[model samples]
Target: MSPNYKFQGWMGLDKDAAKGKMVWQEYTPKPFEETDIDIQITHCGICGSDLHVLRSGWSASLYPVCVGHEIVGVAVRVGSKAEGGIRVGDRVGVGAQSSSCLKPDCEQCSGGAENYCQNHQTGTYSSKYPDGSKSYGGYADYWRGPSHFVFKIPDALPSDVAAPMLCAGITAFSPLKRLGAGPGKRVGIVGVGGLGHFGILAAKALEVDKLVALSRTSSKKADALEMGATDFIATDEDEDWAAKHANSLDIIICTVDSPKMPLAKYLRLLRVGGTFVQVGAPEDRLPPFNILPLLAKDLKIAGSSVGSPAEIREMLDLFAKKGVHTWNNNVPLKDANKAILDMDAGKARYRFVLVNEKHVSQVERNEARENKL
Candidate 1:
């Protein structure tokens, strides 16, 4: 395969890109390496990070960055020394991470925690590789990078639904599964959006005794029930919602990134020794809360980033085995700007996937043409 592939996608030149003004053009990918795989992108999910990068919301973003991480595609090329069991033509996916230093001495890498790999944790976009090449993302026609972060997509899940799981789904599923959200445990999923929806589906698949969906209003009640929630709580509508559901859930996954969320009241809904995990990355500092509630109930407040590759594989397997599927709205990759805007406005039913149908069809055509040639 030639490195002559002309990479192209929506590029954010400045903060104004957040206002739906990304320009599409050809871009260069990192130089080829023996440990790389070139994925012909079929779908990429629009995440909050894409919005943040377009506007430089989270620190300084690399300009002209193609920001997106939830990627699903077919491996068109695989390097000889690439790891991760990748093969040419395999349907695969990449998550928030693209590359990491895999040295055995590295604490994070050696321990099967590549997501926390301290030394060379490079994001899929707006990041630089060890070779000083810019790392592009899946919002493009092709993505070339290390295979360490890539995993095969299960046959049961569609590309659109599987795409968001690479980011939003795993973000919630990891903490929920890690905290033991299975039989005999009551779980609550706050925010009923992409991440929270996955939390509800994952909890149900894990066979939890009871699953609850928590949102500011009861607007999501029907959707939550469809996603397998056994109960729903409208925090704003009910006067004493917290008191009424006091000590009800063993685990709570907060998917809402809003800084102004009612913290103490949410804590009140937890049972003794219950754990509250915040998976959403709020830009602002969290609201201050008294420690009395935590101390009294022996409760825990924690935060989780995306899962490790091993963990992602485990989650994918679980989803396959339990028939867990995501509720996703598909938008053409060309309409990414509109999709992101809708995501920002909270319009998506749960998750959004940018389908690169043209790219996928082109790849298939090219493959057939090359064989004929």
Candidate 2:
């Protein structure tokens, strides 16, 4: 299928773009193949990773990068060989991942862990395809990618709400589900921001016995409680906060990436045999912590990336079934630069999703009307 539309979006030509300098420009997308699908983006969520990449915080980002992964849009072009039964005009989404080697011999791919596929895993933006073409993101008018990474959006979930779920929601959902979060388990979500908010929502949906939200201050206390957190910990206000909650939770999902975070104290909040999963990516190395506590309690520390296609599908179904709602502020796609800056300044209520006025569908418009009622 040939692309009949031009690809254009807000591109960060250099590091200064992180400081609200991104320019609106037309860009070229990767060569489309029979397995590819083209989407006219309606909404794209502003993720912390976008800011990180804009400034090359994690690594030197590719020049002229269009950075966004939490993308929801209408499928305008579907290749004949595309999978997932995607069709033209279907509401769909794409996440942080764009491609991975789907070889039969690859253990990760065969085992349903394609997100961890070591061979040829490609990010949605600032990444290159095997053909040496750059993969553009959803911060623009359109996005083209392999259909394997694209997903059909559920009718029950609004596009603005579902956009962040593609990345932030799945990032939290995968770890909790994998670590056995459910009725009998207690879960603690550290850092109540974009990813942490989803962690609280997912833990609540999983029916955890106790859900605790830990943050530096009590600013997000009400918001966390409204999101179904049973307990809120103000780390800055309470001196004995860690001691008070000692051995309380079975799983702790740390979503903040500060090297100076009280790592050892956070470990102490875990019960015996508890697991602490680190999903936040910090540019600097994590601070050294005492290993004796880990050894004493037999605690385990692990890391999780975004979920696989199967897991993403499972999460979407769960969101629809459980009626999970996201706390998000919508910004115009044209003001993406300002939105990114606000996101970096911690001004987002929880998550910020960019709305492309030109591409919003009737269904999304209807969803907005219903929400107002």
Candidate 3:
């Protein structure tokens, strides 16, 4: 028998709601199916994407959307058709994606790059399923979605820290793992905040030859170096920063979401045949750039989204095995408005995870402690 629970949460009714005006109200969730699972959310990470979609900064969003994609919770109900062998009462998580076209004929899905599924790709928030039903996100008391996108949280990972890995961590990890950032590779992570922090950790776990952290100022130099970055570049501190670091990196993961970012200068830091990845989502269009750098160095510029379920599982195992830790701040669910405001004001030390107090316990909070890598 199905358990009865209220599908309610903080919902954004209009563009102005992004300013910490989200209202707590009951909302309709997608119709449940045999292939779906119900998670009683315990922790949800507040991401920049939530703020963007709340204000319709990316594109027009469906009103009353509850946005938080990095989710961690207990599986209260599991469908027999679920793909991951999930069971009730199991700790699990879901990322920015909820559903995708998983047909074998689809090249991207079949090729193990399901994150790039071109057909019927549904975001966890502000998106509609194939049946036209609204797919809500983790900012609610409960979440119902395709189990194929759900992943079992490793026992060694604390829910508070594991929550952010679903999105921010995977968004950074997917690119580095896919681009071969290890051993002989010299990698640079731009912006030492949410996504970039995880980028540095993942690269270090992969054992890169050199890890460089690029930021606007030297404020985060100590933190970045402690997070496995061997060198730190304060761009605003050095007017000749570009020339100083030219042709030094084989791979650069640019995580800043500004149109005015020094894109050309960043490209110059890449060695010949290097790859530059832009994982940040910007509200406005990026500035136009010269093609000379690309033409001269044979550089490759690409964009990466969150990882697939397989990749998510792989990341969890790697983090657990390496004893890696994320610098995270915990905010109660009721204080979501304040949390989002602080997040917008750039006050989060690294990442913010909303804790549903009624659902969390001391055991989960003190699950395991790893080195702050």
Candidate 4:
């Protein structure tokens, strides 16, 4: 399973690299194994985590890091022992996770919660395999990783649109589904950025009774409504916004990471026995909030990480069935540095997907055939 192609990508050499200074260079990938697959990357979605890692926000990032997780491409090589029926030329994707301890005796792995397998969890980038080789990501010409973490992209989903779903879509989908967001539930999605946009779409696809898009201002009101939100709340415009929407929603998924966000007011928006799940990762600690609301209203506040492999498959199937369209702005792969800067500045309409023109002809051909059908 030796890689025939040289591993090359846009790498962040240091903290300053976050300021649109990534350089194109060749790098070595992890040692290939029978369970691995090599992907000729075509599209990679720019995620907030990429920026966080580049600037060493979460922690010290592995130097010369290639930071991208929501990746889609054509499989150029598939190991004989690779699971999931992956084959050469098949369009596939990799998410935030690359590997975990899948040993049968491990509780998380055996219980279908591999993403939470703390025993040996490895991120797609800035992580090390058990063999001590550094893992690279998909802001590059090719990606090499374990096939178990790779997924076959559905024909109904285009590469550019499908890229963000691996992280943003699933980040929103997992919590909504876990909290039972359907028919009778009123769901509120806080923040209308890349992650929150998918939250609205996922809740809508689940057929929740009401979908509320909450933002600091009304700038994204129209866009949210177009994405199936039943209502929009402008917190900044209304001084009594929280009071106005008090006890209105059964579940709220907070996608904003501001430490100073009005936590108490957000909790007040939930009905009795409601649940609030925080998915955004803030570098600073969340401001302390009163717990009286939780005790009085029987409210539950929690956090969710990315979805498991099984959950990802379920989300893809749901997207295919419901014709869910991701609001994406596609940028050429060479312009990734600029794209990251734009994303950091909140310029993306929803999500920023990097398209590698060299490998996108296959995707174009597929799109053309699907269009004719």
lDDT of 4 by residue, 1-373 (tens): 3555789999999999899999999999987888999999999999999999999999999998999999999998888899899898799999999999999999998888899997998899999988889988889999999998999999899889999999999999999998999999999999999999999999999999999999999999999999999999998899999999999999999999998898899999999999999999999988899899999999999999999999999999999889999999999999999999999999999999999998898667876997999
Q: Please write out the lDDT profile of model 1 over residues 1-373, one tens digit for every residue.
A: 5765678988888988888888898898998888888998999988888888888887888888888899999998899999978898889999999888989999989998888888988899999999899988888898988888889999898788789899988898888878888989999999888888899988898899999999999989999999899999998998899999999989999988777899899999899999999988877888899999999999999999999999999999999888888898889988988888888898988778899989778767977998999
Candidate 2 lDDT trough over 10 residues, lowest sum: 358-367
- C-alpha TM-score for every candidate: 0.95, 0.96, 0.96, 0.97
Ranked by lDDT, top first: 4, 2, 3, 1
For candidate 2, write residues 81-138 as lDDT tens digits: 9999999878999999999998999999988899999898889999988888988898
lDDT of 4 at 265: 92
Clashes of each: 0, 0, 0, 0
Better of 2 and 3 by lDDT: 2
Judging by lDDT against the true structure, name the best candidate: 4
Better structure of 1 and 2 per lDDT? 2
Enumerate residue pairs that collide in model 2.
Answer: none
Error of 4 at 194 (Å): 0.3
Instruction: Write down the lDDT that model 3 would get.
Output: 0.92
Task: Report how far residue 268 has shifted in candidate 1, in Å.
Answer: 0.8
User: Distance (Å) between predicted and true CA of 100, model 2?
Assistant: 0.3
